[model samples]
Target: MKTDSQLQQDVMAELKWEPSVHAAQIGVEVKDGVVTLAGEVSSYTEKLNAERAAQRVQGVKALAVDMTIKLSQLGKRTDADIAGSARNILSWTSSLPTDAVKVLVEGGWLTLSGDVEWQFQRQDAADSVRYLLGVIGVSNQIAIKPSLSATVVKSDIEAALKRRAMADAKTIAVEVKGADVTLTGTVHSWAERDLATRSAWGSAGVRNVVDKMNLV
Candidate 1:
């Protein structure tokens, strides 16, 4: 285990190392095992990248982000322009269905709403729009269509977790009610906990995942 100070150093180093993030503008602080990031960022992509970089540090138990987006003069885009760009990009994405996702932008904040068959498509829709030039924030409200029963969904998630090389699949419990999943158990680290949750979301009809998992 790493001390809070060591964890803070590693997270700062990771922020500096990630090419997409502007580490100088961000501040990192750790208390116990939780890491909090605060400051300003250039774009929504930078914000997401910063969060991911912090999570990559070995001893980060949890992350609390308070960064705000402050677009430079050259980076500004009208909400209409952002909406149009988001629509165009979603339309071009091969993985997403034709016109399945809808876009709305307000004050540089973008929101996606609609339905998709799989979680990856829903995720891809958000990913495509998140990197747009003027996007400050993204809300992925796209829902997954329910296509599997509780039993099948549970089994599928369990199987996926077992297949992951580093995950102790037996330590996690998967509870499904229709398309909703609740994960409850203990994992070795934050990475393992994330892997378990991702495995849960990978199932066909998981519309919502409630993570009640605790780190060891």
Candidate 2:
């Protein structure tokens, strides 16, 4: 196992190599397998790039980012313009909900807050800010609100399993209770098993998934 300091150092090195990051302005610290990133960048993309580079490192179990962005380059734009741009990006994306989410901009730094149905929506909202030219950085404070419905959960599990199953007779069994979906069956590889579980997570109204699938 790599020490926290070692992990931090490795992540920093990786960030430096990424063309999207202004490595000199970024600061990284690690403790108990959690990496904390602090620094200022010129764009939201740079902030996201720094965090992603850290995530790719092997020993990083979690991340805590406190990056600031300065959008001094896009001069003369009102705060409303910045906020509206962020909101437009979210609204254009199919996965995100514009009404449920809130976008705030202060001196070019954008903060996003709201509840999304899927983890991907949360990530996509942040990514949209990165593409905007005037955004200095983004603070992603979105929450995941999994729905609570057994029927939806069961349908999600079945759909996920059906896609990955070798055939209809694979002996896969799916059960859903509340927001939890349980899968029990045998698959040829761990990859297949994991894929099935991930598929269930992609569905709406699923809060938790339990996989008892056996790999042979």
The most accurate candidate by lDDT is: 1
**Model 1 / residue 55 / CA error / Å:** 0.7
User: For model 2, how does the per-residue alpha-carbon lDDT over 121-185 read when each residue is reduced to its tens digit?
Assistant: 87688877756767665788877675667776676567666766545325667888766678788
Worst 10 residues of 1 by lDDT: 162-171
Q: How far is candidate 2 from the true structure (C-alpha RMSD, Å)?
A: 6.9
In model 1, the clashing pairs are none
What TM value does model 2 have?
0.58
Report the C-alpha lDDT of model 1 over 111-208, residue by residue, as the tens digit. Answer: 89999989899989998888898889899999999999999999999999988874668889999998999999889877788788888989998999
Our tally of clashes for model 2 stands at 0
**Pairs in clash, predicted candidate 2:** none
Instruction: State the displacement of the C-alpha of residue 155, model 1, in Å, after optimal TM-score superposition.
Output: 1.0
Off by over 4 Å in 1: none
